[model samples]
Target: MRPLIGVTTYREPARWSVWDQGAALVPESYVEAVERAGATAVLLPPQADAGRLVGVLDGLLLAGGADLDPARYGADPHPRTGAPQGARDTWEFDLLAAALGAGVPVLGVCRGMQLLNVALGGDLVQHLPDGSHQDPPARFVKTEVRTVGGSRIAAILGEDTQVNCYHHQAVARLGDGLRATARSADGVVEAVETDGPGFVVGVQWHPETDLSDLRLFEALVSAGKKG
Candidate 1:
């Protein structure tokens, strides 16, 4: 059977209408990437029943969205935390904790990475100012990251990677049990993984933004298939 990778969803609504009207919802392109990778994509909504999710999924993916609740990692919210979706933030965080506890293969992208870090007892840098990042923050520019060769990530991609980054928050103090597997020239934590097994990895870049970035998804699918 194909691996069922559960992709977490965002909880942003266009407007506060009647409760029965429902909110406009959309899944990100990463969902399609999972499909193209030969894995079944399942949208794990913020309101999903966790008791029902564990047995149904072989892997978990935490996608990018808005800022995380600083309270999650024991810090005050940054000025940019903006209109925080406390409910969605809380749900995904709990979902991630459950995934880790269940030893599910997980790939955290962008804010997903940040969430994974927090869930593992790590902290975030709230904001990245230019000239401060060991390299330029680059904001939305395409950039290169140096992976620790022979690490799981480098072994999977098999070369240096060029990715598009659109995040301001980053892994500040890494969460317990996670290790930095890749980094940008300016010292930004670009990639991370668990110290043990289960193929848990997180990248600060947006692989879903480009269809050609299939190698990562393929690797995850291949790992999930092994389970």
Candidate 2:
């Protein structure tokens, strides 16, 4: 049987046809990527009982979304910071704790990576100095990042790779037990991972949007099998 993977989602006003109302949704590309990687993908909306749901999942994917509340890391919001999604923040934190405790395979993308950092006692830069990560609004741009030798990212993507990026915030202070695995030319952290038996990796890029490469998703699914 294919491993079951749950991808986090956004809860906000959305429109389709004549209906405009609150919806729990994620990008179709995320689902497509998980499917292509040979896992069963499920959307995880913010819920109080999300931690309990992790019991049935072989893997948990923290999908990219809105900015996290700066309060999470004991910092005031930057002028460029967007409003926080309180429900999603609380839910994902609980869900992440449960997943990590259960030794489930986990992957984080873009905003997801930021959340992972903040959850583990780290912080974010709020906004990049040059803002080159996102060239245009609502579109991904190509950015080159080099992975540290012997890191999991390097093992999968080799020493360097071009990734699709659309994030303004980057990892500022690394979280507890996590180590930087990849970085860009500007010295911004691009990827992070923990030293443990579980598969926990986070990347500051939208790998799902870049269908040309499925190594990250594939790696998560492969780890899910062992999980």
Candidate 3:
């Protein structure tokens, strides 16, 4: 059976056609990446009980979205920090905790990466020193990141690789049991992973944005199959 990968979605006000409403949605690229990686994609909306689904899922993919509440890591929000998506923050925190506890293969993208770090007891920089990561807004900028040897990221992306970046926040202090696996030229944390058995990786870049390379998604699918 193809592994079932549960992907998180954003809860936001959306407009389409003649109607406007709050929707639970995620970029189609994420779903496509997972499907192309040979797994079943399941979209998970924010909910109080999202964590319980980990028992049935082979893997968890936390898609990028709004900024997390800084209070999650015990800090006040910066002036430039986007308003907190409290519900999403609470739901993802629970879901991630459950996934970790269940030893499920997990991958976090962009804001998802930040969420993972905060959930694991780390804080964020709130804003980057430079605006290149998201200069024009709503667009991805290519940045080269150096990967640590022997890390899961290096295994998939080699020693140095160009990544699509679109975030203004980054990991400050690392979470417990996690190590920085990739960094940018400016020394920003680009990727992190747990040393435990099950696959648990997070990348600040949006791998799904560039389908030309699906190694990250493929790795998650392969791990899901074994899981």
Ordering by lDDT: 2, 3, 1
Candidate 1 residue lDDT tens string, 44-127: 767856746856788888888778888888998878665667878888887887877777788998889998899888999988
Question: 9 in model 1: Cα distance from truth in Å?
Answer: 0.7
Q: Which stretches of candidate 3 lie above 4 Å from their native place?
A: none
Q: Which ten residues in a row have the lowest lDDT in candidate 1?
A: 130-139
Give lDDT tens digits, candidate 2, residues 78-194. Answer: 998999899999999999999988888889998888988999999999987555898756777788999999888899899999988898899988999999999988898999999
Give the local distance difference test score of model 2. 0.91
Q: Please give, for residues 1-227, the per-residue lDDT of candidate 3 as tens digits.
A: 89999999988889999989999899999999999999999999987676579889999999998888888888998998889888888888889999998889999999988989988889999998667687656777889999999988899989999989999999999999889999999899999999967799999999999888989999999998898
TM-score of each: 0.88, 0.98, 0.97
- The numbered model that scores best in lDDT is 2
TM accuracy, model 1: 0.88
